[model samples]
Target: MDADRISKLPDHVIHHILSFLPTIDAVWTSLLSRHWRRMWYYVPTLEFSQFGNKDVEIFYNFVDDCLKHRMMGMHHNTMSVITRFNLNTVYRGRRSKVKLDRWLSFIAQPHLQKLVLNMFEYEPVRRRHYCLPEVVLNLASLTVLKLVFVELEACYPVSLPSLEYLYLGHVQMEDEILHTLLLGCPSLEELYIKDCDKLKSLRVSSSCLQFLDLSGNWETFTIKVEAINLQSFAFSNTAWKKPCSCRFDLASCKKIENLSLHGVSFYPDEDFASFISGLPLLESLALDQCDLIDIRNQHLKFLDVKTVRYKDRDQANWDEEDWDKVDWDEVDWDRIEISIDAPNLDSFKCYTKNLLVRFLMNSPNLSETFIHVGYCAETETRRREREREWIIVLIDVLFLVLLVELLMFPQVFRRNCRSPLPNVNKLKVEMGGYDEDGVRDALLWLAPSAETISIELEPF
Candidate 1:
């Protein structure tokens, strides 16, 4: 298989295959010929951009002639360094911030390991950021950092001893320079702070942090987390305009195992069940657009709840005639009474628009139950007979039940619905807008012991 195997490799493996192309195809491999002129300047990953340039001074003279041919090819490759430098710009003024601080002090090299700065605002002017350069906190061989709309300043013996993955969007630090940039990244492990609103109050003392994503700190005034080997935690302040008297303290996270809260609004000195019972290894919990009254956990298996369509937040600050002066059919379906004593709960997924969710208890290790409804479940035909009598008294012992999926939109059904879907081994019904008298009243109230039954209808 050697038909001139990629021009017979080895110039550092063809500069690591042109460092994964595109710096305009790695400068068109120097017009491919004389053994590929200068091998794309010993590529070790240098990405520049102006995305589909519309003459932003020819992308600032093509990144100033590719950093002057990578500093004159470092006098003929003296062990070429640059290990990944991505700069995504939209051309700001002041000579593009002095050529982006002279191309980040010419890639503060120590063999830089992954750095991406995405400065946006591609034209409809007035919104300039980009302020980070104390030689980029002295990049001591960084290990993955993505900052967008930058502006962070903290000059204090910052360390960075081999940083490990940090992503900050809409950044603009100053909470003591974000606690000296997380105490100078001591072996940081996956941190993503999104939509940063100048971080009001934050403290994440990490000891090799596992993974933490905190979103849009609206008026964040308290988020003191002490990661004791944190294993996945996510928090979202749902674009805060109100409901964000922020306070999230992950009680010294005891090896948490995946917890996600979107549009979070937890108060009362933040005792969301003593921070989820001190995370005795939480399994999985996701609540979108908050407000799930009370949830008890015993190593939760998986629970997802969705409901909070605040006009899809910020549709240009929504005002399509104030959504026709609100009156979604007198708007009140009252059913936010949720109480779960997760006795090793298996799986429960729910997406609602007309609330009415009542599962006080009884999921003897439920197998899988997914219910998604937006409307027309016959306008809650008497709350679907008390939600099918508490879903057959919550899966009568779930004989290792397989699957039960139901998604309705325009469909509606109501019938005697005798006892059959108890040990649901498989039953699926998804309809967006259907009529056959709504799948014959959802097959006469879906009595399924399941020998396989699938009904999907969603066209229109």
Candidate 2:
């Protein structure tokens, strides 16, 4: 009955509603009314990214016509109306490259605030890539730049005056080119570098950068960041056996509050302690498969360590001779030690392999404690041999203490805290393995306070 109520809305409200719909769908709404036809021109964001199985030429023409019509609708004064332009498609050959270049050149206006160009090769049999045009750097008004599967070279100088956020994933660029790009974006506040194989080192000294994420490049030799205003930082390397020892030099980032490291081994080991000590404002820290000889932080509230053992060829860098020198299976668990000192820590999560753990300070603020401890051996015989060893008993005792601390308010397990089997608190134990029932039965005696226990087969 009130059909015109939808169309009677203000033009600005209509345009805002249309902005969420796909650009093609928004254009189809033109048939609704004369008022709706004109509203499409004011929908500031244009996204053209549907290229599933359609003919490449048809897709290219569709994008071309859409841009042309949007440009024609705008008078000379509306040249800078389009603020966001996103084009994601599978680029095949030189023909796709030409169309992409034309689109980039068309959108290189003074008011373009955000630009995303994600071109991937859908046909795995015939992979093709596009060399990013130098004109993209000339977008002085652009505040965010996200590029995926594009190749960049230092042939052209970089210039992005207002850019604050930059994300480059699966991009191919040399170390010098990446450095030049970082240096050019003076106002950049957030930077992310992922799966860029050519980048060997990341050295960011931007005072304005507030967030930084660098990961997925296994060959990266060093990471040295000195952003004084940085609030969060994350670094990851999935590969286990690396060619060179990974070094993270974040000492100058004094204002950092949150930090994460995954699969990144620390060299000179003591550097891990110094790194945490320097970040006085840190509130959250996560370490995944990273070396943790010592973690001493007074301001930390949440800490998570996922030290799961993963044995795969992908984790191996066979080309490096150093990888063959040490056998991971034969690593001495007794020698592996972790010392933690956090007074105000609220939550602690530890999923570790065989390692000696010692909490130097009683975390008075801790409210939650989760510990998953086990010794993974190469074979069933070796696992049984290890289960009979003295460490297994110690591990059971440690688990009981960890659960007791969880139930009690003030931690009873402080420095020099030790107990064997005797416990008092509500505890739960869950095990995942083929012999889960057997494993649970063996460990239940050590945790008499355990009120709940569950066992399931290992998913993997």
- The lDDT for every candidate, in the order shown, is 0.72, 0.73
Query: How do the residues 148-232 of candidate 2 rate in per-residue lDDT, one tens digit apiece?
Result: 9888888999999899999999898888888898889999999998888777877888989999987784854687888889999
Report backbone clashes per prediction.
Answer: 0, 0
In angstroms, the error of model 2 at 393 is 7.5
Give the per-residue lDDT digits (tens) of candidate 1, residues 313-378: 442244557655655544444555556677787887877654455556545676677767565333
Q: In angstroms, how far off is 4's CA in candidate 1?
A: 78
Cα shift from native, residue 63, model 1 (Å)? 21
Q: Give lDDT: candidate 2, residue 331.
A: 49
Clashing pairs in 2: none
